[model samples]
Target chain A: MSDTTILDQDRDAGFGDYFALLKPRVMSLVVFTAFVGLLVAPGAINPFVGLCAILFIAVGGGASGALNMWWDADIDAKMRRTVKRPIPAGKIEPGEALGLGIALTGFSVIMLFLATNWVAGALLAFTIFFYVVIYTMWLKRWTPQNIVIGGAAGAFPPMIGWAAVTGDIALESILMFALTFAWTPPHFWSLALFVKSDYKDADVPMLTVTHGRRVTRNHILVYTFALAAVAIGLGLTSIGGPAYMAVAVVMNLWFIKGAIDIWRRTDADSEADSHLVERKFFKFSLLYLFVHFGMLLVETSLTPFGLGGWS
Target chain B: MTQIRATHEIHGRRLSRNIGLGIVLVAFVGIVYGLTIAKVGTDPNDDLGAPWAQAQDKAAK
Candidate 1:
């Protein structure tokens, strides 16, 4: 697949493939959490600046995805999960992907600064660099620990949301970062467990590939525990309220229970069975993060009424 | 193969296009500002976060 010559030259760019390169699923979470962070923060930002900040943040998130796809084009072509990606299908060239990613990354960071503050802008810059240079190029092939550490890049949006308001980091913002950072391993490993073939085919090192399914399951359980703790702990903070805490308690339990089911499964159907236990958890994981953050929005909404919050 | 277009060939086209696109972007921003000043100093609503109006009530009061 490194041959690059293998790409289908006849394919034209479709809206969906271009969208796929942006990794809209990941972008949505980034937008949602960043939006919640902006909402919960104690200060005010101009509507124009706030919109630009979110736009740039979304583009930065998308840029990270493009670069990831570019660097992994070789591996991506080999895996069933990504074999149809724009570059692999020759709908977009690897070089095009790289150019788009680098330009957007620079544009996003600069736009973020103009729209918001330097602190948020700087964090956006670091997040893009870390995801591309640090994780994709350096860590992913070499270590199963890649996602665990690289997860920090994904986790920065909420903090960026906070910084955009306060122009600095706050305990509340850090807690949001911590919550997402802690949640990453379990979220990714669950997906890895089901699609172990994707990693194996790509020659990528994932926890399920390196350590085996049971260990992967155990890792998911442990990380899920830590993530749950972080979510609940945020409830005890200035930002959290009865509404947020209630949502956190219910969602975290649902998440942990999902992880537990994955752990207890003795049969993962390694041979094309595509272990549904982890698959189920992976799908739930996306909903888990969105709902948790959405609940924060709910708490903010109900704060005036004084009925649905912690304080 | 009918004709071999090297990677560099496609990339050269993209470079020119992007550069052109970037200049156009700058021009667009300038137009927005120029028109605004010529008319009136109108504030644009570009804020992305939730309005402080809701959170103000929930604030640590």
Candidate 2:
């Protein structure tokens, strides 16, 4: 082949392609929650140290994403939503992803320990392990309850963040962890309801694929109720205030209503509307978590003025 | 004579990767320096530090 022809077929991955392996979107959520967790904790942290801690935590989360991409490349290639990911898209090699993941995992964990405290570092390390090994490797393909249990990995960031400041876990941090843990199932299962075919095609036993859509919808409703309790319960904690309570109440009510709408619909109903309700619920779920965490930050900001948290 | 191209699409990708990595390294250095300063400037009587020193002093006595 001529040089031009050879170059055309090279398909060398770009910076963006490698960044995609880190799952930057998911990393953003981790960063945000971890930031809130650090800020809302009872103690204070140096601003520079806090920033570094969050950065390392985000890197740890992203490392797990790279590892997950490495392991799930096969199924990812089959799913339409993930087919264009770095590995499956032929832009990056799986081995390269594995290497990057391991390297970043080590670097982030060690740096986090040095920047903040052992508790934060250890939590980040555990989060990476739980997500990559437990969630991605073992539980994901094994059972329908994958999302329910695997959600713990995603839920750890805030706890880790709190640990960065306090060097210990507390009721407030656990509540923060529980809030995300409870939110994960409904957030994901809603998307699964609309994307059932993707899971089926990839032979992944998502709740929707293993159980019927009706059961999945029921699960979404159940989890949404649980999530509402956690969200409201968080508002009663030391980190929560009247502003947070207001956000929690309104968001949870809207979330529960969305879950009810999904639960009431059949496949036929969804088909007629092209899964409009499910899509809406899934989209709103993102906003729900963001608003909840944002309010917590607002509460923290209000503390100096004697307006934040319950005295 | 056949003309040779100066740059290929692959070059662009390579350049981007290099630039991205360069920025990440610079940021990493800044973070490490800042963290070191923060850790050094902290009070020895703070949370993680005080407990260890108090225990050591008790043992010595």
lDDT of 1 at A212: 78
> Distance from true position, residue A180, model 1, in Å?
1.8
**Per-residue lDDT of model 1, residues A182-255, tens digit only:** 98999888877665366777778887778877888889899999999899988888788887887788889989
Most accurate candidate by TM-score? 2
Docking class of 1: incorrect
Q: Which ten residues in a row have the lowest lDDT in candidate 2 chain A?
A: A4-13
DockQ (CA atoms), all models: 0.08, 0.50
Expressed as tens digits, the lDDT of each residue in A1-311 for candidate 2 is 79976754587888999999999998888999999999999877889888888899999999999999999999999999899999999899899999999999999999999888898899999999999988899988989999887789999999999999999989999999999899999998888877746777887887776678899999999999999999999999888989999989988999999999999999999999999999999999999999999999999999999999998
Q: Model 1, stretches more than 4 Å misplaced? A: A1-19, A268-277, A307-309, B1-61
The clash number for model 2 is: 0
* Total backbone collisions, model 1: 12
